[model samples]
Structures are given as C-alpha cells and as structure tokens.
Target: MAKIAFILLCHKDPDAVINQAQSLTAVGDCMSIHFDARAPRAQFDTIRDALKTNPNVTFATRRVKCGWGEWSLVQATLHALHAAVAQFPDATHFYMLSGDCMAIKPAQYVHDFLDRRDVDHIESFDYLTSDWIKTGWREERLVYRHWFNERTQKKRFYAMFELQKRLGLTRAIPGDITVMIGSQWWCLRRQTVESILEFRKQRPDVMRFFRTTWIPDETFFQTLVRHLVPERDIDSRTLTFLMFTDYGMPVTFHNDHYDLLLSQDFLFARKISAEAHDLRRRLGVLYACEGARFRISNEGRSLFTFLTGKGRTGHRFAPRFWETESTLGRERDLLIVLCRKWHVARRLVDCIRTSTGLPCIGYLFNDESCALPDLGGIQDSMDKRHRHRRALLRMLYEHYDSDRLLICLDPSNLDLIEDFCRDRSVTRLLEIDCDFSDRDLIEHAMRVGLAGDGTPPETLARLLPTIRNDMALETDTLRDRNFAHHSRLREADPPARNARAIAAFLDCSEPIAGALATTDQLFAE
Candidate 1:
C-alpha cells in the first residue's frame, strides 16, 4: 500500500490542470497544486472550483509570482510540496510534476514499481564533469549572480553580468555542499522528502545564495538530494519521460505521438500540448482500462532510437518510402543544373524537358518564385528554404515517375551548390556559363534595380574559384568550363556554341538535338 502525493506547479491552461488533477484523484492519489500568482485570477478560481469537491485535491496557501529561469519556480514547488506533505500524512512517495504532465501508466503499476525500489528517482549529475550543459554558461551559472530574469529582461541581465565580471564580483559555492545539476522533475520517498524539507529549514544562507544563481529550480533540489541521500540509494533518473530539441526546448507530445508514448516505461510524460485532446483522452482510457496489460512494443522503441540518433546527427527530415527507393538505385537519375542567370536556367530546363520528356524543375531553390505550385508555402523564407532544401529535392525526385529528374539551382546559392556537387546521388551536374562579367552584372543590377538581383561582385569573385575547385573533384559528368575560351567563343558566335554545349551535356537524340540546335534564339543575350 504505497500511497503517493503529487506536487503540481502550474502557470496557465486551467483546463489542462483540472484534467490532470481529476485523473490523479480518480486513481486515489492525493495532490497539492500551486498556481502562479501572475496567472489570471479567473483561471485559478476555475481550477479550484472544478476540483473543490474532491477531498484528495488541495491548493497551496502560498502562491508565488513565477518567472522563467528564476527562483520563484522553486518557491512555488516548495509551497505545493509543503501543502501535500502536511495534508497527506499516509503518502509514502512525493512526485513533482508540471501542469502539462499526465499519467501514462496505471496507478497500481506505478505504486508496485516504487514499492519494489526504495530509491529516489531523479536525474542528478555532477555539472563540472558531465557534458549535460551543451550550449550555455556552465561554471559561470553558479559563480555569477543573475539578479534579472534572463528570459524577459535579457539586456539588463547581460549588462549586470558584464558589470559584475569587470568589477571582479564572483560568488563561491558553500564548501559543505556539492553543486549538482539535473531536471526539475523528481520522485522522492517520504524519508528523502522529509530530509530535504528539514535541510531547507536549517540552511537559510544557502537558499539565499541560490536565489541569485541562474535557474535555481533545476539545481536547488538536485544538489540537496545528492547531499542527503547516499549514492547507492538514488536512481539518478527522472520518472517522467521527457525529450528536448537541439535548442534545449522540450518537445510537446501530440496526437501523432500516441504509439511513441506507449513504448516508454516511464510512469508519466510532460509538456503535453493543450490541443492534444484525442491523445490525452486515449491515454487516460488506456491507463484506466489496460493497467499492467499494456505492453511495450519494439516498433516504438526502434522508432525512438532512429529519431534520437538522426536528430543528433542533424538529419531531421522524416524518412519516406522514396528515401528507401533512393538507397536502392533511384538516386542515379538525379541531375543538378547550376547557373547564375535564372532566365538562362529556365530556358535550359525547358529545353531539357522537351528533349528528354523527364521531370525538369526550374529555380527549385529560388527564394522569390518557384515553378512548383505546391512549394509556395516553403518559398517564403530563405532560411527555411535552405534548411529543407534536401527534403524538398527528394520529394520532387519521387513525385514525378521518370528515369531522370533535373533541378535548376542558382550558383549564388553556394551552400546548396556545394552540397549538390558533393552528393553521390547527383550523377550529373551541368554548369552553364552565361559569361557575365563583374561589370556586366553590376550594370544589369543598376538598370533593373531589385529585379536584377544578381550576385554581388565580391560574392561572384569568391564564388568562381570555389566552384572551379568543387568541379575539379567532381566526376567527368561535370564538363570543364574554360571561361576565357567560352568568353572568346561567345563573342564570336554566342547562340551556336551554347546550343552545342547544352545538347552535348544532355546527350540528346538526333531529332531532339536538331530541335535544340534550331532553338538558338532562346540562348540570345
């Protein structure tokens, strides 16, 4: 009979909080919830009235105005923890959770699991030695005093930090306490919770010191639990299943993640989106009905493993069936066309489409306009287009059923151009040199204004050598472009030489070659 007490800290979304509180009460667990003082009074009253009839639910007497990356979060947690402990004396375990968290496992299963293991389940690691703090200030987090809210008042925060640095103001951690860093979520046994409360009561100076430290909610309880509990008695892992993006933001669970949630052995999951009504209802039903019968499947675990590994390596694209086809052999048909002038590139793509009757797309990576009607949504932002460039190419490659797929790219897109040149899947790269000199480009930009958005002189100067080097490493499919010779030849007879080059690169049949050769007017400057 291991009864559990839950300490829920919430700021917004009263409906979600009420649902979670009701779910826990239905399972016979007592909970104390603390709403942020900054939240709307109506929201707090709504949640309180919704669960007022349930004797297992209690609201904290003290509410704190919480801010992100501040000490008020810890204050809120402490308030709720104190209320829960005082109200539910028979509870054997105390769990800290957010308003967005929901139980993914049966109450009996959780109770039995805790009954078997007498250790506290929390994520605690030595910050100095561990690689957990990936991209932020590590030692500086503790040594520097962060008086301002880093999220809301970033300018003031950085200003104060710099002033402190220049003035040689630094704080030292107490010699008696070892600073440990971990997630804010934890599940502690009654004895561990009691010890932590007692420690907090006795150590006022330490708490005051941490009040100025960065994100004390994550480090406060984590450092104390390690000081109180022995190494063998702690699990050093959170009972809540959580995942974060590369930017360190939590990934919200949605309806599509139902199968993924079933695979996890953790008793609860957090940061569940408010819009995920179906997912929440289904998980609640499963928790109530299935209980221990809900078995973990290998499919979910395998998918999670693949997603996690791929996410780490920056392969964030969703795997498609055509991607499998690409691995088999479909990649050989891929062809990339590079040119500085969009109109010339468009003419070349048209010629290729007429000659080969294959899927030839024009300006696939163009920031302004794309040939594909369906790609309008992704063409709005240059950064987004660059990020999803590979995935878009793959989708187009699979969209049109043909032996060859041709894509037109502007040489100004050096990043994508480099990727295309190095890609083994791209069997051919046709670089059509329109022979526009730096003076010609500048004059054109001046005449046409923004319409002639050609590459700048400095960029073109840097781009030409890089392209030559990249083309040198490429296979024979990339024909050598002697710019000087091409310039001399184009000065003599521009249309004929350009037509011959296009026909030669495509390896067109006799009839198509004749059609392309006569279409010399399309190559006129």
Candidate 2:
C-alpha cells in the first residue's frame, strides 16, 4: 500500500495535536509537526515527548516564531513540508492540516482516495476576480507594502494602515506572477510538493514579495501551483469542513454539530476543540463503525432538509449563527434589514443609516461583492480570519452607541438579530425586507460569478435551481416579516421606496428626511 505524509501545524493545543497524529498513524502514515516557535518550551516538550515513541513521527528542526499575516506562517508550513518530504521520500501524497483537524473518513478510504486521484486537492482562484475580495483589499495585499508589524500597538498600526491607504501608496503586482488565494489546507501529490520546494529555492524574489502580503498562506502555494504546473488538475474545494458565524468567526464544533458534519462529503472536519470529548469519542466510533462510507445517520437524514433547503424555488439551508450576548444593558431600537440580494440590502443599509442617523455594518454571508474596508490586523494563519471577525463584532457592539441601529445582514443571518436583541433586552424587533424574486437574485448572482464555475448560463443551469430552492425556503421563513416582497411593500413609488419600507417596518409617524433625500438623490443619479 502507498504511504501518505501528514504535515500538522499547531500552536496552542498540544494534546489534541498528539491525539490527532496518533489517529492518523494507525494507517501507517508518516507525520511531521511544526509547533509555533512562540509557543512555550513546556508545551513543545509535552507534545514532543508524547509522540517521541512513534518512530514514524518527525519534527521540523526550524520552528518559526509565527505571527498573523506575516511571512512566518508560510515559512513554518514550508519547513514542515520540507522535513516531511525528506524523511518520507516514499510518501505518495501529503496532507496539510492543523492540530484541531480530525479525520472523518477511515484511513484506508482516505489512502485509496489519494492513490486513485491524479489531481491535486487544492483550492485556487484568481484573487482579482474572486467574489470574496471584499473592498479591493485583495488588490491592496499585493499592491501595497504593509509596514506595521502585528506585535505592536494595534490601534496605532491600524491608524497607520488607514493613513497609507488614504495616501494611495501602492506598488504594482509583479509582471510575471498572478496572485491566487484559496483555502489553506490541501493534499498535494509528492511531485507537486517537491516542485514547490524547488521553485522556492530558485525564486527568492517571489518568496520575498509574498512575505509582506496579508494572508499569503492562502495564496503562496496556490499561486505557485497554477504558474509552475498549470497542466496539473486541481480541485478547488477543500475536504475539511469549517463552520463560521454570521460575523465570520469559526463556531466551536460541539455535540450539536455532529449531524451537520456527517452531512458533508469532506474527509476531515476542523476546529474540534479539546473540550469536545463527546464529539471526539463519537467521531472515533463513527469511523470505526462506518469505515469509509461516511453515511449520514437516520437522525441526520431528517436534518438534511434543514441542512440543504429542499422543495422550494430556491432552497436555503439554515446558516449557523453563534449566539453571544452584548454587555450593554440599555435597550436600543434595532432596524433589522434582511435580504438575499446583498447589493440591494447594502443600499438599504445606507438608506437606513442615513434615515436613522445610526451607523450601519453589514454582516455578509454570501460572496456578492469584494469591496470592504481593509481591516488592519495581522493573521498568523487563514484560520484566524474568523477570529478577526469575531473581534470586529465585539468592538462594534461594545464601542458604538446610538438610540437606533441599522444592521444589514444576509437573510441567512437573520437569527443573529434576534440573539443580539435578546442579549441587549430590546423588546421591539423591527424587520425591513428587501423584495426580489428568486429568479432576479439568481440572475444577479450569475452575472456576478457567484453561481458556480463556467459561463453564466452553464453555471446557472448547474446552480440556479439549488440556489432558487434555498432562497425560496429563506423567503418562506421570513414570510411573517413586517414588510415583504410582492406585498403592500412593493406599492410604494421608486423615489420613496426605502423610506416607505422603513416607515412600514418601524411604524413611525413621519418619514426621516435623510432617507427621503438619499432616495431622491439615488434615483436622480
């Protein structure tokens, strides 16, 4: 049987890392770990000692003192990959993973899957065109030289980043290279892995360029693969399942997420915490019982409808939201704006903010547009993206003060508004609905390249019906809203539309002049 190599990167959870490594070793896979150099000596020794007896296990000699959004993260991964390739020359495929990741498939099945496939299981997309570019920051990552180090005073660093951004100081992307970004975890063929190492040795300039780039791990290998070996088939989806909150923070996987995990076709699931003993135990039992089939349980079958909306024009699975209470005890009025069309919702957010004189923050669930403010923070890894989002959410909730608040979020994240209110003891739930047919949303999505791969029509044919069903289900859930599409809400004139929607939802006696002015100006332009 062909052997596989596992490159495991870890920082905080040594025990979980060891347990995961031991589990993988059962199938006789070679393992190499790159513990963060910033981690304490005691933690490192504990992990080292736990796996010391395992002859197949190796450690990266040059551990990196990793920092978020710095070159160190990529360097650490490179160190591990190099060490693994050197020690396990016979290994056929190498799987890059984190300490928190756990296998959902049997070792034999995973081995078979890798052995049979010639394609590299890596997610890669043109950074310029990807829908998640959020605020042209993707362009800035490559175009600007990030000067502020993450270890210093963050407030000052962010101020500096903004100052630089305002100054329009940007560098041109290298003529020879096209930047690509995607999920960091990947399973690469040994040859592909070796090629990357060789390329890195030959091209120090490219490596240096990426060193200052934000979240380069998401792009470095992916960009190199596309440039060096375009002929090599690449699968754009990762096998690891990670659940995120409305704010883009990773939701901790607990017992409730078990069925959710089983519903996916992924071989592994990430972000399993050390505290999830029951879930870990159940996972072990699942692998032992089912081997590689990865069948959904009878109970989980019932959840399938919930997981993937069915029987609707556009079915929408219930998007998960993490519930956290705000510390503020004072009750504030909330203007909840929910819609499937993000662009429309975004406009509505601006209208509501102007109308209510409250700042609006959109929690995007779908990949609609990439224009977002470039958040100034260094991420040590791609996994930290959610952490940054969570921090952003906390900061906004804690710092922003107003009598009224306008929140623009994807329809999928509507439940979060309820959680937010409940935490703040707000009794009134004012819901504003944006009206658009499933067809309209689908058409817009297809136009924006959100539907799927290929040409609009082809991708539409492939993805529209499913998305339509999802939207229909979502619409149904929000059917009881104060305002809705194809209802009395649509009767208003175009110039007074947003004002009417707000008036109708909030039951206000008078229209806010700001909203009317914005609507008039928007229509005029």
TM-score of each: 0.60, 0.57
Candidate 1 local lDDT, 280-376, one digit each (tens): 8877765555345545432333333434543233322333343332331434456667665567667757876876787888776763566574654
Judged by lDDT against the true structure, how good is candidate 2? Answer: 0.65
What tens digits encode model 2's per-residue C-alpha lDDT throughout 1-525? Answer: 657788888998777777777777765788989999899989999999999999789999698988777777889999998889988888888888888787777777676777676878888889888874554365767776664555654776577677778998777676898888888888888888999999998988887788878778888988988887665577777777766543556656776566556645677888886788988877765543434454432222222333344443343233334323323345555455555555655665576665555666664323324333444542223334333433444444455645454555565654554344444434233333444555675665544435322223433354456666666666666665443222223313454554555565555545463254245333221
TM-score, candidate 2, is: 0.57
Score candidate 1 by lDDT: 0.72
Clashing pairs in 1: none
**lDDT: worst 10-residue window of model 2:** 483-492
What is the clash count of model 1? 0
Model 1 TM-score, all chains together: 0.60
